[model samples]
Target: MTIEVRVPTLGESVTEATVATWFKKPGDTVAVDEMLCELETDKVTVEVPAPAAGTLSDIVAAEGETVGVDALLANIAEGEGAAPAPKAEAPKQEAPAASGGGAGKSIDVMVPTLGESVTEATVATWFKSVGDSVEQDEMLCELETDKVSVEVPAPAAGVLAEIVAAEGATVDASAKLAVITSGGAAPKAAPEANAQAADGKAYTATTPGKDVEDAPSAKKAMAEAGISRDQVTGTGRDGRVMKEDVAKAVSSASAAPKASAPAAAPRAPSPAEDAAREERVKMTRLRQTIARRLKDAQNTAAILTTYNEVDMTEVMALRNTYKDQFEKKHGVRMGFMSFFTKACCHALKEVPEVNAEIDGTDIVYKNFVHMGVAAGTPQGLVVPVIRDADQMSFAEIEKAIAEKGRRARDGKLSMAEMQGGTFTISNGGVYGSLMSSPILNPPQSGILGMHKIQDRPMVINGEIKIRPMMYLALSYDHRIVDGKGAVTFLVRVKEALEDPRRLLMDL
Candidate 1:
């Protein structure tokens, strides 16, 4: 019997994905849950797993192809005839069924509805060569779309037999990618979720090796994969392959059956070797959106920034004294951000114009403060809101800030977490910046930029004293917030920070 395996729907509205890479080939036996391939969207990456235990019969797709959520990826023969055909079709629901000897079967790599608006993706890459052995749940290829990257994995275990698509080709979300056949005599399929590789293991733990020489190559495979090296079953000695083994893996990647090294692709130029050429990747959806929003704020608002300086001695002392106690009691850190955030809240309350939003022809002012804090991530910048700043205590504010910060780093924050903020606070000092003219978040009238605290001598009561001081900046929508409002807003923040109790007192 030839069984068809398909890609599953990634999420609601997400229609397609891009092929990332394949982890297995034909002729290899795959246990259940063994990773087969990786898929990518512009937003995130997903792992594809094998659905059965069978010989990998054919490869219907090549690397760098796009496929849909429910498209046929491969076929698995019940016994030794597992050809492990490669799937090349991008996801399309109209795909007809292909059967084996007695009858051709339909292999379905499902069309992925990644988001409400996303209907299709471009196929990215395929991992296996025809005749190579494939294991269940081993990655086969990758797919790409507007949101993130996606991987296609082996559907079963078997030897590879076909190549479906050429590399760098595009396919629909429901298109086929690859196929696998029963492993050995066809062991009962294991649960997919429970078939994950060992934690932090050098290679695929489910297929651990007893030999020792292949150890170095296994480690190398893990590193080049960069994303899910854990998903690959190591063929190295003791299942350990170091970085040095990458050349060997690449050389043998395209050959199967009686394997032989294929000609290597042209190598990428190193910075030291190629001084003139600079390669840049395309901008991500989030980054493009961020650029548009920031430029919109600049063009739409009459913005201006004012600067001020404050001594940091008192604030430093307070943080040093209460940091441990506050953390112990509230389960949150005692950081300078809370102080600055509180200060901004107090200041915004005093200068209402700074907290107002420009809604078309009207100046809509907010009574409650929803402060937006800027957090940096590999994707770009995201500002998450600390809702109802007036109502939360210092510890609560710190806790909220930290939680949102973590979420931003993990790319787990949602759209709702980013909306409805009336003002923004950005701290460049965390990266060793002394001062910066902060930009404003759109609609809101003001933003505050915090600078590094440094020791400098200054005259106080007719005597020079060394003290830690910081510079603050307030960027405001000058159309609503005049010079007075800007200066007042910054002072309020400075005062609140200097007198830590003022934020507590609501004064």
Candidate 2:
């Protein structure tokens, strides 16, 4: 019987993938659930497994060919066609004493599936070293992708035999990371360690016969501190050097200089001296992705910014009155974010174009508001989405914002939580940014920038008075959102915030 192989469903927003590699060729005997091919999409790598024990009969999609969901990839012929290959190898397996005596089965430790749009990852740390015994499902290493950190667990209980991809190396999804000999005992001492000890030389635990590379961040830190790698004892997996190690080394080095050397006379350094002191560090994967996407938005969109000011007297007064009660009731503090979120939702209803996106040759209007709240983390800036914000109450909005913000800072957000935003709100106010134009988050037509609120003199009712004022900037894609729509959106937000009663009345 012949069975057809088809592409599985890719994740949300992914439509197609390219055949990256074929593990099996035509007429190759394959077991059920054996990996037959790998597909690479813009976001993640997917492996296609064989449906049954069979012979691969044909390849309909060759490597490097693009295929959509449910497209034919190959075919399998079950039954007699796959029988002969195993019988031919029977003689070699018959010698059980030679093959099984104190030897265990070797299993490959592969990189786990990364989250959406993540193709590669850096080996962040290894929790186990070569010859270390581990249990099945024990975490062996952690891989840092552009989005999140993924922990790779052992596939079977074993002693790790080799490290194929060491710390500081970049590896693609499903690539071999290490080898584990299932059921194998850990050695008392490695042969190389004994030999090096006898020769009066120190040995570092790493892959045999290969030099372990130091992390790029560590290298840059070392250069700036004027310390060599030999001075720091690495605490990372397999004795890999890390940035934290360099920091400790620098701390120790600083104390020595203070104790042993006399204070130097102050003088301006020469250009040559300045040049020698500079250190270069490579950009991280998250930073690179942010740079690429920001540049792409600039290159593709007709971006423009509109500005307006808001009187915070009403919103601030309203919040101060009910904050204690609201926090007690909802178990979340009432903050400016909920007010801004509600204001934006109210504004989006009036200026729908600001909440819409441009597809190929068409404009897609979203009736529901999925607000993206831009947050800054130590790694980089990220936008986590709150679905259907138009229907959420002030308390709900505050709780959602607080939860997502906490997760974003800790790098625990999932891909689904970060996608599907209809409009964005970036609050530079927390960082004391007075007034700055914000950039539009791509696909979403508009982004609202909220700046710091300060007391300003304003003429209200023909009298000069001090009032809390904030500058609001609305950045939009001119291709889909007209200038008038952008201006109207900002005005609506200003009105809602200035008179909090307007929001409650749905005005």
Candidate 3:
């Protein structure tokens, strides 16, 4: 009998992947669920595993070649002789059973399927150590991907015999992470003591003892922030300090007044000290993708920026008047984003070219608006799309923005939440940017950039008056959007924002 190995689903919006590595070659004897090859996609790396115990008969997808979902990767020829290979090594496995107090089968703990568009992850933390007993379906470790943190659970109740992938290791889907010896006896000491021993650290009489070990990522974050362990509180299992706790501590410390003198200013490094001072760190996958896409947009589009300023006096007053009542009724705070999103949706209807995209030689016009809101996180910049924004009410728009923004910051957004955007809006005002020409998020014709509102004197009705004003920048692709259309879109947005009633009336 012959078994075919095919690529699994690559998640939402992911259609293809490039073969990265092949662990087994043709004619190699393989066990069921053994990893055979790896595929690298734009968002993640996927590992293809053997479906049955057999001899790998053929390789269909070679390394560096791109293959689509459900594409043929390889084939296996099942033979009777293949099933007896493990039985022949029975004596080698008996030695462990004699010392460990039980004769049991060893099971491989493989990486689970990461949610939408994610293919690979970094081993963030291990909750269990080698020789520690684990319960079925109990969380053993956490994997950190570009989009979210995934908790990996144990496959079955057993003793963790070996840790194949350690902390900070990048692993693909279905790759072996650890080994569990089923029905093995628990060690003499507690799991905590075993963990400490494995890490080469011990509690002493002279030193202060801690309940749980600090997470590896948390320690790195504290070092980078110049913070001490005693300053930040732990929130993880058994009072272990996590990376997020250190970040919170750093943020709180920045807002407080310093009681001590400031440190000396950095001076120019001497030739001898240059090498020691400079550090080189590899770019993360998210950062690398951001760089590539931004450059690609610049190269492909005939980008042009049109600037217009809007009077924020009306919008600010309207928000302040109804904010309390609005929040009480809708359970969401009234923010400037909802106003901008609503105004943009109104403006997009007036100038459809700004909302359209170029598909090859043809221009594709979308009647509905999928608004992309650009958000910056610790990893990099990401744009989460709000579907059918044009049809949503103010309260719904506010709720969606709040939810997606929170998820984006926490790196919990899925790929589907980031795809299918017809237009994008980026508010650099939150970071105090006065004005910036935002780049186009490819395929989309335009992006609206919002800047910080400043109280400036304006001549209105031939009289000089102080008004809260903001500069709006519309960057559009000249190929699809004419200068007139781009200018019209910006003007409409400015008018709608200056008079909030215009958005209500759909003017």
Candidate 4:
């Protein structure tokens, strides 16, 4: 009756997750859709549910364990015609065992590197303290990176035994931040102690003013304890010390009564009670991810954006005339994205290089267009791809786009739905932006940015008059795609968008 559970796939590039919690314990009965445990991936937290009604028999994994996708998680005694359990690789308990962690044993937990190029983060604040009950997916602390404040969650539910890193400390990616145990020890004011050094310096092995003997070990211990030598109390002989001393110093300091977060900086936003009021809003998951990816993509890619303005006279007239009928027939309003998406698809089909990805040694050209439309939600920008845009009916495209967009705003889009796009289109014009030169999403050679429609003076039959003009920008990887290819691809998109009939006729 033992039904084995496994880690569901998280995202396209995600290979593993740190256990955040075991919501149900042994002998607990669970419903078919019940959340059995929580998982913290690099990007977000996800709940792993019980596939069927069952009695939880055992947790094959513990909190804080990093498990690969499809790894066995727990075993439940299925009720009534228990479906056959799916096969999984042997549980990764062996790896943790091999790495040397014993039951009830405590280990150092550190801040992980979020990306390849990111080096470190500043500890903005700690949410839990020593002896505090911690839960999986519960925010443990916040880290201020170069741009945003990121909420870091506890890998598993346990007693927070220590907070090694305090607010405002800039620590390396691998720096230790806190310690957890099955039950945290009560807060105790650490008594100062000194290690009699060979050089006769009384180095107090406690937080602040610690001496060191080996620089590497000191750095490593400091990295592991989330403390700098400047803040640790050294009591070694002649101010010379070791790693154990540093760890001891960190633990003692953490055991003390902690201070409350100081009132927000004078300049920090405060709530107002007047009309035209504003509220300080937290950056959402989508927004943070977007900001990180856009910045990272910019840093990694040699990007260049080409600009061109398109006359929307024909498309505008077509939409205005058929708008009511099209809505009545298709059950969706005619928006500018379909024309743009179709135009991008046409351009990509012609210049397959624009649809290609850069491998280390080769370029991968996609045969179909998985057009990514960046939907701007209250949470932020999320690009959900329209699978095989070339094959879908206009109504189908509208429905898919509508559904995906709704799900994105609702934070319901799965990791799979957000992935696998050959190219991206981010329309700044939706926010009524006059113009924008967007960046290329990594791996994709090109991205098309759309802007607002505005009336401007133009020449027509040797006379100046008002006309609706739209600015378009195409950002491309200059390394893989040449200037000519970029311009040609953009020109193709422009031509299709200008003459809406071309998109319908497959031109």
Quick one: ranking by lDDT, best first? 3, 2, 4, 1
lDDT of 3 by residue, 272-301 (tens): 786654434445556667888899999999
Q: Between prediction 2 and prediction 4, which has the larger TM-score?
A: 2
Error of 4 at 11 (Å): 12
Assess the local accuracy of residue 455 in candidate 1 as a C-alpha lDDT between 0 and 100.
96
* Candidate 1, 267-303: lDDT as tens digits: 9888876643333234445666678888998998888
- Worst 10 contiguous positions by lDDT, candidate 2: 190-199
Q: Candidate 1: lDDT over CA atoms? A: 0.65
Model 4 lDDT on a 0 to 1 scale = 0.69
Q: List where candidate 1 sits over 4 angstroms from the true fold.
A: 1-276
> Candidate 4: where is the Cα deviation over 4 Å?
1-285
Off by over 4 Å in 3: 1-82, 85-99, 103-105, 114-127, 133-139, 142-151, 187-269
What is the lDDT of every predicted structure here?
Answer: 0.65, 0.80, 0.81, 0.69
Ten contiguous residues with the weakest lDDT in model 4? 86-95
Candidate 3 weakest ten by summed lDDT:
202-211
Per-residue CA lDDT of candidate 2, range 103-207, in tens? Answer: 665566777767555778987666776667889999888777876667889988877666677666788765767766765455445323321222244434655
Per-residue lDDT for 472-501 in model 4, tens only? Answer: 988888878899998999888888877877
